[model samples]
Target: MRVKKDTSISLFYDMVELMERLRGKDGCPWDKEQNHVTLKPYLVEETYEVIDAIDSGIPDKLKEELADLFLQIIFHCQIAREKKEFDINDVMKLCLDKMMRRHPHVFGDSTASTSEEVVQQWEAIKKQEKGYEERKSAVDGLPKHLPALQKAQKVQKKAAKVGFDWKDINDVIAKVEEEMEEVKEAIAKKETKDMEEEIGDLLFSVVNLSRFLQFDTENILHKTIYKFVDRFKKIEKELASCGKDIEQCSIEELDALWNKVKMNARKNI
Candidate 1:
């Protein structure tokens, strides 16, 4: 599986050629069998790996993950080339055209004094170019597969841009409290369906509150999950030191160990 290096070609072009070879008849069976649909999960997985590397604060890891993500792009382009659909050049050309068209402030006569103005102008241009004019709502552009929290934030932002949001931060806080009360009432009724709906409403209101406070719900939730995992592992370590297993511990014992773990964490902080 050796590729002849061509010094005159750009690195990106070489990579694309390498991908074509991998999908060729003489290449790896696994690579040759993958289509865009079958490779979708790898595309998503590599994207998150890139984000994780960035979060890890490792430049080398980030670079490696980015290359993995780029390989997915090349993989798809090679598949498209095989089917005589389109190729890498067409992909780059369309991307370049899209960027040029979207940035009228830089490429055209349109003037934007601020980032917000630039974003507004870009959205307007995107709507016109992407057939969004036929859509009934501004929030129609978000993908259905987007995470629930991120979807909430995007739709809320779209609506807020058109002044369909709470008047102030206090209003958002009040709405969250109202939702919480409804959730409590639903719990008292003990109906599963009502409880589920109320819980969702409460979560949505909390996402709104986070948005109003200029915090991303998705990111904050990720941080909280990491914290939980770290602290729980510490509790497990303490139990192991005492020759005890977590599953053998009572609820009260676990609660005490959790408190000790939190105390130790605070001390370290």
Candidate 2:
């Protein structure tokens, strides 16, 4: 008996056509020339743009941004096909298989009564399927290429998973204070390397605190930076209204403008 395929054949064929058109001789030069390495920045940018669109709470923009991210996946698949490697179909199949294997509560006899139990089982199944050695720490699989803030969070979570974590939020808070003290000590010693290391430790401890408090450290930092940019832009506009550019403003004048913007922002909020 012939085995029946599980997905939409027409849609798969359409994706194939689209990929071929993009890589064809008459296709867009940039799309045809792009490879995995060249598309790395674009993949990262699209991911963040999607996140921003989601945070903006605009469904239309979120849809468009998600489409852009999907396009990157397709683009990468097209490049792989050109090299005679697996294509999009292989990717879909592998993902489906992995999901089915991981979700034994749904697909097999393994029992999971809560989301927490499901997560623990999923992690166990993932390790088993990946043939991860017993000696492999939970942090072993974290990608080094991740952004520093995200990497710090992932490292903290992995350590937490293995019980090598603070006892409570209070413990993390105390650790943060200790790390800050070390940072100050390094600053007082005037040792650049020590200061840098202490600063990193402080940031890492903060990431741990974020984890305990159920916050995404990366997202928190992003939101803080967005607020800063908005306030700084207000300051710039205020300066421009007075026929003064930022470069022409004295430090005192800028500080006053910044304070004004902060007060106005809080008032509006």
TM-score, predicted candidate 2 vs. hidden true structure: 0.89
lDDT of each: 0.90, 0.88
The deviation in Å at residue 186 for candidate 2 is: 1.2
Clashing pairs in 2: none
Cα lDDT of model 1 by residue, 139-208, tens digit: 7788888889999998899989888888898899899999999999999999999999999999999999
Report the lDDT tens digits of candidate 2 across residue range 81-148: 89999888899999999889989999999999999999999888877764577446667877768998
Q: Model 2, which residues run further than 4 Å from truth?
A: 1-9
TM-score to native of every candidate shown: 0.93, 0.89
Clash numbers, per candidate: 0, 0
lDDT of 1 at 187: 94
Best by lDDT: 1
